[model samples]
Target: MPRPKSPRTRPTWRRRFALALKIFVGLGVLALIGLVIAVYVARAQLPSFDELKSSPNGQMIRVHAADGTVIVSLGPSYGEWLSFDQIPTVMRDAMVAVEDRRFRSHIGIDPIGLARSAKLAIERRGEGRRLQGASTITQQVARTIFLSNKYDVGRKAREAILALAMERKFSKDQILELYLNKVYFGGGAYGIDAASRRFFGHGAEALSLSEAAVVAGLVKAPSRYSPTADAEAAVGRAGVVIRLMQETGKITAAQAAAANPTGVALAPAPRQNSVRYFTDWALPQLETLIDETTRPLDVWTTLDLNMQRAADAAVRANAPKNAQGALVTIDRDGAIRAMVGGTDYVSSNYNRATQAVRQPGSAWKLFVYLAALEAGHKVEDKVVDAPITINGWSPRNASGANRGEMTLRTAFAYSVNTVAARLGQEVGFGTVADMARRFGITTPVDTRPAMVLGTSDVRLLDMTRAFASVANQGVAIIPYGITKVTAQGETIYAQAVDRSQVLVAPYVAQQMTDLLQTAVNTGTGRAAQIGRPVAGKTGTTSSNKDGWFVGFSSGLTTGVWMGRDDAKVVPGLQGGTAPARAFATFMKTAVANRPVEEFDTKVTLPEWALEPDEESYFGQPDNGVYVDADGNPIDQPAPPAEDSTDDGDRVAPPAPVPQSEQNPEQLDQDWIDRVLDRTPAPAPRPTPTPRPAAMSAPPRVPEQPSDRVLIRPQEARPTQ
Candidate 1:
């Protein structure tokens, strides 16, 4: 009874087989219907064949130096388009051997190749091997031209459909031509012709067998195998391609051996790839200047290859090994002539000249002094360079001890911090910030009192542009690199000469220039002096984290910055030492052929500005003794004594000024001695005074030129 019941419930084996067959058939029909819908959808979304063929390949920006030398080619660069016949036979064979040996036999998709690739992938699973791709040359053409790089079932199906459609519409030769013209090779090169020129410096038709293998190897991973990126890796990859050529019977063993991938000669790279920094800075400007970027365009820039080479050499030679350096040189009209963002462009592409924001230190004083001049303060006006505390923040000069009283010119030349802080207060912080903005400082300016010493961060480019405004005789300058942009032999954009509005009065700029000129000639920036007239400011931040020298000479303004990327202190680093020296070395060569042009000298200087700063010449008048212009000690008349009081209400006599401290003038002399290669005689120091119990010590002075000096009668200079 149990056996009979089971048979009745389970039904016969034939009946069971028929039911399973029906279900399988139903599922197969559903799958076929879904595939049909997907094909229809994909076809609807695809572009017309003509539209795909006529579309621009990609955007390319070819930047040229002022002399028409190619500085850099950005984005996808395409060389002359080559027809199938124009391509070399070896190149065509190598590509086929490496990418798809069955390219000619497959009907857009190769089932056998896909099955082999799938089996290899399954065998290599968990072995840390890269998954194999089964894309044929036709499939690659379809994906590259008409589809995205998304790796998914939907994308694969669409790619397959597109490849089939292309095979139906175009001849095999036509498909190969499209594939060769649209594939991407590294270093921004597009198309076989471009790839050939990029790697071998020759057209596709002129490609050698080894070079052909090298170019063909780039098809798998362009960046990894790019000859310019890693020549050895590229050569090794080419060797693999050569082996494939031999295995596929595309070349005989002797032919492969003679190919000698290792002997392939790559094109020489640009003398200094650091030019990329300049091009990177200029590329963004194109977005705003032009309306379309789909077509290839030629950008004529203001960069001078000679100046750029000099700048690169100077930075490399002068920058400390433990730190980085950046330099920006612009014409008086704000044309960027040379830009070196770092010592090595390959290691890091961060454009410090245009992108990094760091404290400029004393260099920020340019704005403070300019505001004072515009506020009707004369360079001859006396300002006290003594200890000052504002809102609990005490600022000290580079010298620990203050030089009691000095002219504004003396304070500026010496870069006395106390004087700058007092001036910032007297002129109003808001006004100082406004002056900086007016002079083209685009970064935010802190209105705090300490900002007078350049606490706010700023870019080297902005600071250079601000100084260029002064060198341009108070005319505002907007730093620019591109001079013109052309596409298809037609001008798309051209720079206009529009630096008309003045940032400061000509007279104010003249006075500021006088101070800056003195700074370079005898002050903190003494190391930056070139034989010709030069005006510049040196900046060294706290802990020597950053050093900067920004100057202008012979109608060129250049700014140099040195520091570690991490903003860590570099021992013995000062703006006057490395940055200023770099500035001088670069300028000497940058302006060697240009005529020497002096700064404007229409504004007359005050008598004090022309005369020697006595406080600087002698140690700050110590105790009751003062030094004469002749450098002899002279006693001053004593003041009347105050009445004695036991209640502690009487004022205490001012503490005796320290005699061991070197004045600004003495610092200047020391710097001059170094520059002139003169060993200076050490000055005698007086006995140290006992410190008062309640008096706090001054901040330690940084090693720098902290004193001013007299412009010798023979070297008397007019206001510039």
Candidate 2:
């Protein structure tokens, strides 16, 4: 009786057991409900990812020139348009078997597969192996379309959600197609097609079972397992995939054993810049082509890529090994179609055409001739080439002394340094600087006394632009690379262009162009002649530190520059020697297929248009604009007269038609009376004071040249 009262232990135990059973049943019921809800939600949301791109406008684009020349590139992912039928059947089967065996049975979420994976994962913490990818093709496709390459439980959950949504909306075949097209295969390839072509030089549909396994294996880590990019790693991965296939019964052991010797045969990717020169000319003008996003825009220039290659080959063929060089070609309308900044892009990105500021040498003389014509000088004007001094800066002739009193034609033909300097000094340096600036030479120029001898540093691009202005009859058009840009056929940006304007008098420009043509034909630029009406000028910097040839054809304008990177000089190679030779080489080959045409025939030649060989071509035909036939002057000069003349022969330009005596006709008779009286011409009345300001720094004196210079003649060996 006492024991019974102390404890009804057995009865109490039964009650506690009943309570535990009830709690367990309640928890099971709740868990089952939650799982059903999760399954339904996953099935609902999984297929939405396949409807549209999660990242719209995420396109990697390439920058092209006006001539359809590729320059730079943008974007990260590469995708191809394809269908499921295009994929290798083996790839789909293997991925389905290993990644999601129950893929066909599940709606979107595979809970049974997940449960088995969880159980095995827990059981084999020590069973180390290569890799384990339980993601189905749908899940992988969803992740590729919407998610970043981040590893986390959240990422996995999100992948599953998207996969479910994707599977609901897209057929399994569609998901597979999207997966193959979106997966990266490394080595700059973006999709299965790209990867297949890159790795095997064939289509993805043509892949063998072994090849399919190798590619499928790369889905986990493209860069790490790319057969073409990394051989040893890919072989090891392919072996793992083959083993998995055998273990999973996708392939037999005998079949895998027969599929031996895994290797990747690599092929080099072709360049998009087949017309590099055309792209180069278009780059500076492409600023307007870019959207705020810095995306690359396509530009179809006038370049023929194959012909461009021939042109570039011609330039590089002559370039000295490892030497620096630049080339540019454009249409007469200032549409640049081709360019080569250097011999090789992998070596340097310094765009010589638009970046290198070097002495234009005789090329600068073309501008000087223009100035002389505008200053009333005819082509027949004579100038004494005797040794002359500009404030102790003695300007000498390229040829020996005393090309004495030669016509402006011979002086320009010979590229006499002294004559050019004298004309520049007489016409006003400010005028020259202003003319150049108006013609699109944005680079700063110190219009000093030295500039008279063509001592300013000029880029090949600017030089060519200036020549183009002349070719267009003073219509100075800024060269533009990009013409228009679009995304999926939607225009985002456009290149705004202004037509050419009359810079110099049309006749003046034509005269100058004719001079340049003669330069290519018979002057220092003779090497630039390409069996066509190619107008060009040769330039050699002081001491040969730089060489240049800038010219234009009816269909194209081209410029070439040659020098050393270290600023070292090269011997026996002037602009006419190497730079012009390079230009001619490119031009001859570039225009071989096109008909030979003359300079712009529309450019009217002025009555005063004198040949470049005319003598006594200094200081205008009869005082230029200062004294027209009626002796009517225009565009008066600035005043504040001081010393009318400077030391040496630098006489100040006519004083702004003395504000009080603005009429040149009134002073005309007075000027004639003084000449007739011959009172020793009263030492010639001086005009305004001469400004004594130096332009840029002194001209560089070359010590020698570089050996590895580019565009070297086959026999032209550069001295060490």
Best by lDDT: 1
Off by over 4 Å in 2: 1-58, 62-74, 107-132, 201-210, 239-265, 270-287, 290-303, 490-497, 600-720
Tens digit of per-residue lDDT, candidate 1, span 428-489: 99999999988888888889777788877899999999999999889988888999999868
What are the Cα lDDT values of the candidates? 0.76, 0.61
Please report, as a residue range, the 10-residue window in candidate 2 with the lowest summed lDDT: 643-652
Displacement of residue 654 (Cα, Å) in model 2 is: 44
**By how many angstroms RMSD does model 2 differ from the true structure?**
14.8
Q: List the residue pairs that clash in candidate 1.
A: 664-706, 664-707, 664-708, 665-707, 665-708
lDDT of 2 by residue, 172-233 (tens): 76766676776676766666766676677677777777777777777778888877667788
